[model samples]
Target: MPAGKSQYRKGEYPTFEDYSIYAQRVVLNGEFVQHSHDFDEIVLILSGTGEHLVGQRVYSLKRGDVFVIKGETRHGFRGAENLELVNVMYDPRILLSGEGDLRAVAGFAYLFLVQPAIAQQEEYPYAVFLDEDATETASTLCGFLIRQLEDCAGQYQVAVQYGFKTLAAYLANHYRTREDLSEKLGIFTRAVQYLQYNAARPIKLQEVAEAAAVSQRHLERVFFEVCGLSPMAYLLELRLRHASLLLRGTSKTVAEIAGECGFEDPSYFARVFKRKYGAPPNQCRNAKAL
Candidate 1:
């Protein structure tokens, strides 16, 4: 692809308004152009070969190649023969915000989250390549998802959500079973999974590192490389996110919500919550109510 910059926005697409998800299949004979978007994308290579340009690195692409593009990460494809792929574009904040269980799946965090974070890093290895059977299965699921998205009829929204989640879970499980997963990536994935599973309880860096079978220093380095946050910081982020959702969606009191979210002190929770959200817990809740 030529060296240039372009951007795609979610609001520019019709399907984004209803469910914040869109699917499209494309065939590229030449270059697809270097561009970034405001939403995340899951790319599934259905057939043929190409060169995928991510940031400053270029990687070979082929059938069954699966990877994620985080929002605003400049990338493109070139040197294509018959590059065919399916792009599932979505707003993760909308599709995955409340799906804690799905995030806890064995390889979900690695494939969707850690991969994207480390894509441009030197340690970035390769995209997840599905075998022939898994590729066919994934393609079928994508076809059904695309059809539902195009139909856009009554109750189709729910069906589309279910279909996407099913595909995501399938891919994650496949990643979990892959024998080629890098050791560093595995450690990061395990650490993240442990953090997500135990976010509602008070957790220490030592606990997270032990869960990943790595030392605290190594764990911190991996977390910084993949998430740009320390382990404790990431846990706090998870806790605060949960607290925000509860404050908006439930009738729980501030102190109760604080404890449930793993904050031992209501006053500390309120102080930090205000620092993060720019309002006290009660005020934030009331604002959401109005």
Candidate 2:
């Protein structure tokens, strides 16, 4: 590993060689500019609600939500009033290729080495969500690591190694991959992910179908079966949701917010926003002000 600075400075400066494990407890009353990191990150939400823009998908965050952010992916956090969380950053090599007894295990090799390699090779910024119990266990281990790093206690490095491995193993057990999914299901899943990642763009059915390696008609069938919404319908829902968040979080005018969220027509955006939230966009902004 080498000491290198990522262009990202919204959080702490991330350097892989300085520490294999970097943990931070962050509180954001505002927003984090869209940025990317040079290393993988695990985020455990401790409190508050917010929206996480990872790639093109916007995930609504709440307590007990856990997310894995692969390296070099663009992400942002916004509209959180009292957002707090523990973010753990580590070099993938620490667990993937690092010399360790865990490497000998078949499951470990499959989860850490083989699966991640495939994901990287395929260029998918996939994320994993932990269950409630797993999230609690992860949070506890992450807390210990954060405290030890801050305290500089004796033998903290040993603790870091132990805790990091334990957390990795825990996640490996609960982790699910899309690699084993059925073709139709896999295509549908990717289509959903595509919408999440590109909902704010001028997307079309043909593009999404191509991304899934399927025809538009076939994709529509699977999407309706799995998500009960057409791709365009889902994209509209995502755009409207983003518009609502902007209305509450920033003072941007309705037109500006609409454009930013991918709605070309301000009047159409207003109509949809009003229908979804039961209030007009300007009224929503005003209500938030009070």
Candidate 3:
């Protein structure tokens, strides 16, 4: 993001600590000039279709798809239609802040983008599939930002912060472990599906363990290691997350959704939900009405 060359209408954002997020609508109807970014970026294709040429490689992109641009990896785009792109440029130091300050992401300097087929555990620079969680957040943030950009409201800055928060929440939760392949690769879809589908059911470690065909102890180890959560804790999160969705999206009563999503007591559900989401179910639901 440099100063005042918005003919790309592509301008740098200000005051973003770790990274900057930008929305570009490409309508040039042809190829773009070759350029590169010094920082790491994860770009989402919000609408339209195009091909990204990085060095000698040509990658096709479509709606609901995303790609990662490694630092200093030469790349450019060619859009045949109205292409909506969301670019998240990050400071590698922030990502390496918690882990050792080694340049692990520097690996991407040669690879360019992480294509979807290999987007599993090997899915370095991961992208999302059309599953419930991925699709919901992808469309929501894209739509929200597009609206803010269109309206140019005085509260646009607040909306922009919120937009980044939603993207952060989505990526922090789903980025590393995304894949659907069962054999040959331990894709995350199976584990997430197991947690969501059986959240309300009698979830014993052995059940998911056997379902995944791995031993109970091994499954427990990976659940925490890979997902950053224990089996039971993840189950609680799934139930609560779904219950929150129901509260916001429907007129359903809290008691009804609590039971539907697996809580036996409405009062206890309210207490736990409040603790997790920072508000009681009724308040969260009513906040929607506001």
Candidate 4:
């Protein structure tokens, strides 16, 4: 079968070489094929209700319900009528660095790495029920990310990264901890945090969803409902913006700059840069020199 039409087989959801982090809004009308990916995912119900099958267990889902799917976990959605949600996909390491190790960051450890581990041992999929306050805060952050992704000018990468960090900090400070996972932060907040901390590194959507303790569909819905762009669009905007700055402010060669900006191909980076900025990389450098 063609990609995305039926269930995704293992390794079927290809991770892009140059980019990581992806979110998209999904409108489910009927049953979807069972599929699995190589990355983590988070799903949040925006409207309507459905049954989500993750591995062997099934969970009844409705508005404000969030589900997290580990990489390579077989899952699908069923019994739906106008079921809408956002999917946030990313890698897990996005939130951890030298000082940001998972063990060091209590929130990161609890939601992303720890919860899934426990859920796996217990043979249950991880999920949560977001309260109204948490829901609104999450919706606002998702909206902010979408806006920055769609703006298409200025230092959007910086903006998106900042937004992600703000979202993360908000969740870390406000959301419940592992001991009291009963009251949790909004799914969108966790996702934004993951994006903010890990955007500069090589990461993906599955990781982001896992970190936020949600399903990919849930992440995408808030991003679209609030900002009107997909997660990848936002990530691309970040890479190009950084590349443009390097072109204007540094003497680094285009190839070197592309690698620094997380692009595997310098030529492709140049094409994307020109498309977004209306000028070639050399022009930006030359203009700065003059």
Write model 2 residue lDDT over 158-248, tens digit each, in one string. 6677767777777666655433555765676566656655665689899999987899999888868755778788778767755765675
Error in Å for residue 212 of model 4:
23
Ranking by TM-score: 1, 4, 2, 3
Which candidate has the highest TM-score of all?
1
Better of 1 and 3 by lDDT: 1
Better of 1 and 2 by lDDT: 1
RMSD of each: 4.8, 16.1, 14.6, 15.1
Better of 1 and 4 by TM-score: 1
lDDT of all predictions: 0.80, 0.66, 0.55, 0.58
Better of 1 and 3 by TM-score: 1
TM-score, per-candidate, Cα-based: 0.77, 0.50, 0.44, 0.50
Tell how far residue 83 is off in model 4, in angstroms. 1.5
Q: Which model, 1 or 4, shows the larger lDDT?
A: 1
| Total backbone collisions, model 1 | 0
Candidate 4 lDDT tens digits, 63-170: 766555665577787887788887656543334322333323435534554344334333333455466677567657766755655563444555655554554444
lDDT of 3 by residue, 1-290 (tens): 21122122113544232223454343434566556654456676666677765555565666655555554465677654666666655533233223232222322211222232233233233334334467568767766765665565344665655665555445434442234433422523345556555666567777777766777777767766655777677778868866866775568888898998889889999999988978889989743331
- Residue-pair clashes per prediction, in order, are 0, 4, 1, 31
- Residue 203 of model 4 has an lDDT of 72
Which consecutive 10 residues in model 4 have the weakest lDDT in total?
A: 10-19
